[model samples]
Target: MQTLSRWENTPTFFPQFRAALLEHVGSSATVVVIGASDGRLVLPLAAAGHRVIAIERDPVALQGGLVQLPDGTEAHAAGLVERLQQEQLDDRVDIVESDFLDADLPLAARYDAVWTSCSWHYSANHHRPLADFVTRMQDLVRIDGLFGAEFMMPVTARHYLSEHYTSPERLGPYFTDGWNIQLTLRTGQFTELPHIGQPHPHVHRMGALLATRTSSVTTERA
Candidate 1:
């Protein structure tokens, strides 16, 4: 795992990923950001005019990032209640800080779309149990809501031995779903990181998927 300091400073690689999400979400939507480390995506979501509920388990990081945001950011520090308070969002976005497994699905809140990027790999129980996590992720979205995620492909021992590193796939089962996969396209040569004092070989293969929930599940209780 990359150090928090390093991960915090590193630039976002998949810029198009964010754009795709914004386009899918539309305007004046409510968004929930789970595993929001340092509010990287939250800022953009809010800036796009979405009432964002940013969820993070690490209080230090959450507080630190929230403090940096300008007023009217509408962030929920450690719970889902703040998400439930936004009245303008109609089946739009709702951020929750609870573990996905522990989240109460029967609550009054729901989202028109749900998005998780490069963060689902850290699911407490689903890290190794990829299939289970995918099912849980599917449950979070309202029928036809969008689900987007990026994960590392599994690596082989021989390949790891040669490469001296592991890819996202090797970490676990976050990539086994039946959704259509889009290969990430990158241009330009690799650049080294001066801070790390090494050639930062930009090596990673990412898969982006969008699925429309076909089930009849409604956002509100009957």
Candidate 2:
């Protein structure tokens, strides 16, 4: 983990990741981004001309990111909706403030793609009972819909503290049956977080997974 300031100084890694994500976003695609700290993913999704529903539990971080955006960006902050709403967006792009674990999946509506990055590691209880979180994520996508995620792997401890390390082998059980393992790679980089003065060290092996649902399901089923 680099200092916050050093990390901020460099161009974000999302741009490249976003390029990969766009391939899965069709013309009528709807998207949901969870744990969207500081709207890093939201800003790009909005800029890419896609409608996105960005969910973040931290109000302070959300507000901090929102304040920096130019006016007229199509984004909203709320909890998941009980029913999907009709809106001008290709699919509704919403920003919800709530815990991803407890969020009402039925309210958020189904999406063409559900993408999360670097945030899943923070799931409660080390993402215990993996089935629950996996099901929640899979539910967000329509049948044959794309699921894209960037998860931290076992080697993360080399760059930062021992607490940040996670192994993909431990994370694999959460995926529903028939999910495709599209990409898995071990890569390392020095992240500079200058906000804390000294650059904190971090090493991470990222696993990028792509999967699709076996059946078409409604929000409630999701």
**How much is 97 displaced in model 2, in angstroms?**
0.8
lDDT of each: 0.46, 0.54
| Tens digits of per-residue lDDT for model 1, 1-222 | 111322344445435555655665567665556565555555556646676655556654443323222232333232222322232222344445566556655534556555555565333434444444455665565644555555433243443333212243432233333332233432233342432222334444344455445554432210
For model 2, give the 10-residue run with minimal summed lDDT.
79-88
Question: Model 2 Cα displacement at 47 (Å)?
Answer: 1.7
Root-mean-square deviation (CA) per prediction:
9.8, 8.8
- Number of the top-ranking candidate, with TM-score as the measure: 2
Model 1 segments more than 4 A misplaced: 1-14, 65-95, 105-109, 123-128, 155-203, 217-222
Candidate 2 structure quality by residue, lDDT tens digits, 1-222? 111211244323455446545655554466788776655455546546667777778765554322222233433332122112211222445767788877666735678778777665563536454345556787777766677666665543342343334444544554436454444444464453333223343433565656555565332321
**What is the total number of backbone clashes in candidate 1?**
9
Q: Predict model 1's lDDT versus the native.
A: 0.46
